[model samples]
Target: MTRARRALIDLSSTSYYHLIARCVRRAFLCGDDKYTGKNFDHRRRWLVERIKLLSSVFAIEIAAYAIMSNHYHLVVKVNRQQALKWSNNEVICRWYKLYRGTPIIDRYLRGEELIEEEQLLVTELIEKWRARLFDISWYMKNLNEFIAKRANKEDGCTGKYWEGRYKSQALLDDAALLSCMAYVDLNPIRANMANKLEDSDFTSIQERIKQLQSNNVYVKSEITHQVKQPKSLKPFGIRDHARTLPFSLLDYLKLVEWTGHHIHTEKNRHILKGTPNILKLLKIGGATWLEVIKNYSNHYGHFVGSKTVLRAHAAKNDVSWYKGVG
Candidate 1:
């Protein structure tokens, strides 16, 4: 059964989430259609650029992402607090970037006084827009809808492009966040689509690697350069920074590379060698981490975290249980 979005997403529990969306019938709409022999590889760029644009407008931050042939994965951090801090005018400005406003909003923007009713309407619209600015569903809706419309127009047809509602998994803790991010970044290697992490096109890991190489710094606590990291993606911070991932970028890169190497070497065999230091700090066993990364989608339902956290989340939502409790 499909649960309500409100029930699935509890910001009080966690702000990070893993989202997946697939093409209808898994038809490779974003890649080369084997049947039609029409390459749609350029569509991947469309998705990436749209994601960057949306992240800039919304308070949500892109932690990790991978654009595959038939589907894509996104690990996002919804900064509700950031959205709350935006002034009404600021909210209106951001909303107008992606959507046209009503005449009343236009008048308000132009410094014209609105009537009592118009003022009330403007207030209501701003509130709604403010909520949506940090909303993951709205973010995905805007992204998927834009791509669907463009792709449909190109194909000269009118029908559904996405399989259905994008799947979401709430990350209840740092461990879950790290693991899910690694799973997303290693998607290409797992699918045998790419042989190396740097060669994995259309992936956050690749972008991060390129940025690090270009900057020529791996051990620095912070990259003070304006181009410290990919502007489209979230920056990494070891401390509890409000707008950054709670980990070091170097550690994350090492973890992804180590995991990818093992995953690419043998899909079924578990090698407990050359585990990264980040894993030790997180206290996740080498074999167990590999299993989770290899079969992440199968290991959880709407929520992913420690068993204790899962139970607490279920109880908080007034449910008896959630899947992946085992």
Candidate 2:
């Protein structure tokens, strides 16, 4: 049966999502033609920086991301409670920062003289803008538009640079969410872009690793996470270490590392080719990792490793995701 189209995403129901956006040209933006070029290296840095900057402005959180040549993927969890509580004026104020102000907006902020009725109209307009500010469409619109313009300028061209709309998938369960994330992080490996997740440039995993290593922060699997994670860990992969949020930054990082390593193992290679290995590993049903272990080894390895190494690799995944987005 055909599936019903999703009504507008209800931020209230769930903030987490797996989003994918691709460029218009078949293979123009990425791969050997892209990420490696001297001119475009900054583009990789651009994506990570933009994600860090934008996530601050919006109530969205990025969990996992992989910036490939032709396309990009992001897993985000929206902070619905925070967004819903924003005052109209606060929302409008934030929205203004993303785009240039119009005459009406400037006049309002400047406290210039205006009729009582005119003030009311402006109030309504701002309310609308505020609502848009919290919406994903607005976030993606600004993100995409800004990059497109920058890319166009760099290429010395002026025209539609991206496709019409981005594609989105609902991560219905932890299995789906986790699998998608692993898929994103494994992008470079699958494409032969990098030998391992750590070497994958411009990814969120890499960023997380660097931060953890530089400082005394927990950035590994559950076996390693002794404390909670920040809110940014919720699906928004990027965040300043200073900020705090729900969940153990430590434990969450641990989980991703555990799942990720399993995904990259030789036996799981078939999954990259669309086999059911991922399903089994997550144990949706008959789907279980134990079976793979039996087939690939004598018994299930079941997350046996060093926390530091595991975390380092996972952080590398995060960093690469952010870096590659450009």
Candidate 3:
């Protein structure tokens, strides 16, 4: 059956996603070419920094990622609960960091002097940015467009650098989330780009490793169960100083490292046979465990296709087109 690029995702249903974006030309969009020999390592850094910066603006928390020669992967959790809590003005204030809006927007977001009319305008503008912040399409568009413009200027070329559209998979549960994260972190090992996850350059795994060692990480040690959850189904807190379960922060980091080693190589493949232990760590039922493992096939861009039924989606994902249709 034919399918559109993306089926509509019930945003409220899932707060986490696995997103992938690839270059237009499959050849050397990211690596050093043997023929022309142009390098794009800087471009990879551009993406990483941009990802990190965007996280600061939006309520996105990046769990894992890998940037390859022609493509990149991201395992991000959208804090919809937190994002929805922000006042309309707070949303605009944050978005204006990545994008430049209008003159009134600058004054409003910056806390500068404003006319009574400007105050009213700011109120209305914030409403718009607030709405767009939760929409993944808007999030991706903002990220892609910024990078594309900068990249085009640097390469002295114009037109599309990205493929048709970015792809995303909603993680049905924790198994899907952790496994996909491992898949992303192990991308370098699978491609022979790096012998181990620790050495993978320009990857979140590497950045995270550095952060872990240097103690630059912002991950809170308090588990959600211990700390008080916000009163709202949507959290009233913008950034919670709490962590997920299995409180030993030290143990969790070790587990993440061990997971990286598990799928990294042929000779070391046997080291990951502690099925019961692994399952226990991720906290999943055996049936759910097997189902998630089955989804990790080679057919669909290194991970299973998303649950989104593409049939009900639009023909294209262009923002203007979507607005017109709506």
Candidate 4:
């Protein structure tokens, strides 16, 4: 059964979520349509730029992303602590970037005097915006609406451009988080759209690769030793730290490289190489991890985590059964 977004998203359970927004009817609305020979590649850039801008405006961080032909994947982390720390004025400023504030906010920003009642009203509005500034639903709404408007206008028609609603999957542990991030980063490779990470356009992995290349350390030995991930992404911390992705950039890159090769290889008879140590630390079997990434959507529905975490989340939600996750 389909659950409400509110029920599925619990910051207490976990802050990270993987989201997907697909074009209505699965049309080639954002890429080339071979049947029609219509290229809408520019639409991909619109989403990429907007996502980057919105991440800065909202208290959300983009951990991984892949903008595909008709859909996009995002691994986002909502920072409630950061949003709570913002002052009223700061909240208004951030909200105003994406939307025009109400007259009361205008007056507040202009230093005009407000009666006590109006002051209270303005305070309430600020509080609401502050909460919304960190809300995943609000963030997706802002993102989808912008692109929908642009695509509708360009197509000379006005109707639904996206599917009814974006899908969300909760990542409740390091194993789930790591595999989902890799799945997102390797989307192009899986689709045969790009053979190499650097060739994958409009993806976070490609962005990370480009950043390293610009600094002249694109070689494997150097990247494995020293290349820091771009600041635009949530850095995979070098140590096993609290409240962060648990692997270093080097390990992540190597894992992606190995996984990408397996995905591209056609022969099933080839002997599989040994699993990376990171998977062992996470207590995920190597073959199971690969299978999860290979058919990510099939293995998860609403929540993706360890068996214990899944059981606990279901119990907390009063759900008698939780399916599709191991």
Q: Which candidate is the best by lDDT?
A: 1
Better of 1 and 3 by lDDT: 1
Count of backbone clashes, every candidate in sequence = 0, 44, 0, 0
Q: List the residue pairs that clash in candidate 1.
A: none
Q: Write the per-residue lDDT of candidate 3 for residues 11-70, one digit (tens) a residue.
A: 544566888888895345577867777887888888877877777777777777788888
lDDT per residue, candidate 2, 1-326, as tens digits?
22232432544334556676778854355444543343455666666667767787888778877787767778776666677688766777777667776787778778899898878888888777766656777778877888788888887788876776765554434444454555566667666677655688877676666656556653443323333233344423222332332334443444445544555574745333322333444444322432332232121111111233324433543422211111
On a 0 to 100 scale, what is the lDDT of residue 45 in model 3? Answer: 82
Which segments of model 4 are wrong by more than 4 Å? 222-228, 239-244, 266-268
Query: For candidate 3, what is the lDDT?
Result: 0.61
lDDT of 4 by residue, 1-326 (tens): 66788998999888899999999954575778887788988988999899989999999999999999999999999999999999988999899999976988898889999999999999999999999999999999999999998888887788898888999999998888898999999999998899998898989888877887788775365354345667778876755555456787667877888888877773675556877668777777767777889988787788898778888888999986666544
Residue 130 in model 4: lDDT: 95
- What's the C-alpha lDDT at position 178 in model 2? 52
TM-score for candidate 3: 0.71
Q: Which order, best to worst by lDDT?
A: 1, 4, 3, 2
TM-score of each: 0.94, 0.68, 0.71, 0.94
Better structure of 2 and 3 per lDDT: 3
Candidate 1 structure lDDT:
0.88
Residue-level lDDT for 66 in candidate 2:
78
